[model samples]
Target: MHVTLIYFTIFFLDFVTHAVKEDSGYWRSKARMEIRRSLSYEWNTNEAKNVIIFVGDGMGPNTITASRIFRSGETSSLAWEDFPHVGLLKTYNTNKQVPDSASTATALFGGIKTNYEVVGVNANVPLRDCEASLNTDNHVESIFSWAQAAGKATGFVTTTRVTHATPAPLYAHSADRKWECESRMPPNATRCKDIARQLIENEPGRNIKVIMGGGRQTLKSNVEATESDPLDAWACSRQDGRDLVDTWKRDKSARKVKFAVAENNEQLRKVDTDQAEYLLGIFANSHISMDWKRDQGPKGQPSLEDMTVKALKILEKSANGYLLVVEGGLIDFAHHRGQAAQALRETVRLSDAVNATLQIIRTEDTLLIVTSDHSHSLAFNGYSDRGTSILGIAQRSKHDNTAYTTLSYSTGGPNNYAYEITNNKAVRVDPSRFDTNEFTYSQQAAIITDEAYHGGCDVAIFAIGPYAHLFHSVHEQNYVAEVVAFASSIGEYGNKENSASIFAVDCILSFGLFLTMLM
Candidate 1:
């Protein structure tokens, strides 16, 4: 409700400015610059102190557009609509036109394009097999790594496996990005150590204060040690027999790391943030369910919003501030399913998470950025009103009649099911209503696409907090690095000192006053 009111207030202010400009030709000339300046003042700039980045995995432009219509009652402007800055990011790999999770995440966190399957390393050479692992040693330092080195508390939270692509590369370095655990993706026993083991047992103690998400099954064994999984032998030393969780407990450096294994939301909510320094909450055995199925979340599962809020509470305690990365990991799952309804629903969930984050952000010191690594092919089509349903064909009218679908599927129907575009813009409830139990929600509305597979669509990014103005162009993926580096006062090469330039410093102070009138 607060977010909605805030958005409406901003809209009204923008409307008044537009009206004034229309009445005065002279005022129109300065409108663009004035708009930029007004936006520049929307946050407190005097004491820019922290940085938080929220990445909606696989959420592109089409995803945000679709989500807006569902979440806002009617589509007008999104919460991020007031951001004066915008920018494009490149997601292509050094070897392929399309990139995978490992390389895409590596580029975002590591700041260099790597091979399709590599993590935390640059792809300098070509012609490597798809499965060939890239060495992660000596790569660009991750933002989390930098934060830890600078004496700031650093943490990772996600709906995906904690060691998954997006969060793993931040602290773990390995030749094979796919190796999730010492037991599953074991290191070459003759050549190297296990990345998963290093992630828990080998890193400098107390660096990662909080680690949350799923993949616990991969970290533990049903019984204890055996010759079959020698890693289990080490696990047997602990009562729990979970290598990752147990190892952290045994390490003196991590004794201060507050650990919690929340299999459900109830436990998550009860977690005492004050006492927790290093937290590990794996809410699911695998990846947590998407929002559509979130209602069916496990007995104690925590909503993504709950986890994010808890994470912020813990990170905010640091004197030097902290770096926290929260991932809406289910958006990618929705896209992979080619279920637009679920995709949009989850995007709305992501928006709710964003709203919650903004609630606790007190100063302009924090830079809050929301973006996707790449895009999918899905998009908004046809001329329709704000609340028009995106699930079916959109029809145009000629005097008194409706038009037919300009786009639709070619195959897969009972009697070659043909749909018509209509002014009946009622929201669709089910996309697969008629299909058998083999699939669910057939009647639910969804975007019609050429393939049953996901496409490359443009991703949407919204920002309002500190240094967000830096992201205002259609540039490459590495642009995010520049924005974060500037916001956190970290240098590009990881050795430079933190400083807020004139614009950055001013924006910080002005944003507070601007929100009073504008928000």
Candidate 2:
């Protein structure tokens, strides 16, 4: 009986080894298929009639990899990963190595590297310098302005407040990104306008065909809380007593243009794209709930995917084409709170939005770019097995003999050092005792501080459609705006004179290369 059992054990081990080895052929075949696809790939050089940019805030390399593993197994890829052109962007601001959303947004949209915490203005204007920001020489126009000048419909969508830093650069020129409303502005700064006020009163902002996101509190006047006014319960209304929402509606009405204001998911869905010349959606008083916590409250807010699809419907009505900016802004918020689960889920939500856009728009005439403003300090550590859960503990620390999560921040989190005094000495707490995969679980961090810091590492840029090949190498973050301008024949590259100059330069370079070959 003992001999028979030993032979059976040996047979089972052999079967398991052979089963695992069988996957090698599958991997080799998949690699060969990818090579063939690359060889047959063709560039789309058509003039980009429509431009859509997706910004995944704080989505670093570590975040992408972990999210990929979490959503699918180790070998799978996100929707944007299949983009033909991939590049790395230097995300440093003019004044800071590790950048903030405002400066990075300025670089990405305004095509200039500006001072940290400043948006839609040049580096000459320091942070919170209202006087300098008011100078016309210091003002920088973004791609939205260019698109508007070219007669293209312009719009933006985000999971954060519409006046948030990532979306602010599109229209609002602010010395301080924190000035979301008059309430947040300094008392002495009478000349400078708040970001929310700029959205309703300024040029490009007033002209935007679609404005969808949160910040009802910033736009509405302060009112007494009542059961009938559920939205005002969480509201910190503007101190100016001016309801920008009402102002926006009145402005649109005065222009004699048909417009719609949607306050919830149902209202947004009911908007008539064919008739409404403008659409403004404010679903939350603050930043929209994270993907994990979305739709769990009394009011229903649209998902990122939901907002993207609806925005595309309205923008597609323009004859001269359109420019749409969509931001997965909550990924950064989740990372700031050290919630890796929420961050990864937010990334997946972004992926879903991208996929939804793909289904609605054709790549032939549209330029779609996906990138991040900055990255977080989220670190993916350990050598776990292939099938191990991304949120699960990878291994026990050799030093303390305590288990650690695979996903952890490099520094700054509330639950950084979970420990107990056992022999009058602190020891690392084992995370395996509780459900680390829980959406609320705070990932372990190296040090506890106010929040996790933004990483200085270069972020990834993925592009598809017209002139997407422009992003085939490393570049400064500002290069993105230049490529969009060139592809769409807008901004500095819009005129025939500039196109002629570029053609002349190309011809000269070709002639030089021909002479060198003869030599």
Best by lDDT: 2
Residue by residue across 1-519, what tens digits does model 2's lDDT show? Answer: 132343344345434543565478756865675575566558888999999999999998889999988987675667788776899999999999999999999999989999999979999999999999999899989999999999999999999889889999999898988888887777767899989989999989999999999877888876443332244332245877798999999999999999999978788889999899899998877778788867733358899998899999999999999999999999998899898999999999999999889879988899999999999999988867877899999898888788998898887667655666889997777799889999988877887888888999999999988999999888999999989999999998899698789879989999999999999
Question: Which 10-residue span in candidate 1 carries the lowest summed lDDT?
Answer: 228-237
- Candidate 1 global CA lDDT score: 0.60
- Candidate 2 off by > 4 Å: 1-24, 223-237, 296-298, 500-519
Deviation (Å) of 474 in candidate 2: 1.1
Span of 10 residues, lowest total lDDT, candidate 2: 1-10
Candidate 1 TM-score, true structure as reference: 0.73
Residues 48-116 of candidate 1 have per-residue lDDT tens digits of: 357777788877776776677656544255545545556667677788776766677777776777776
RMSD of each: 10.5, 8.3
Clash pairs (backbone) in predicted model 2: none
Model 2 earns a TM-score of 0.90
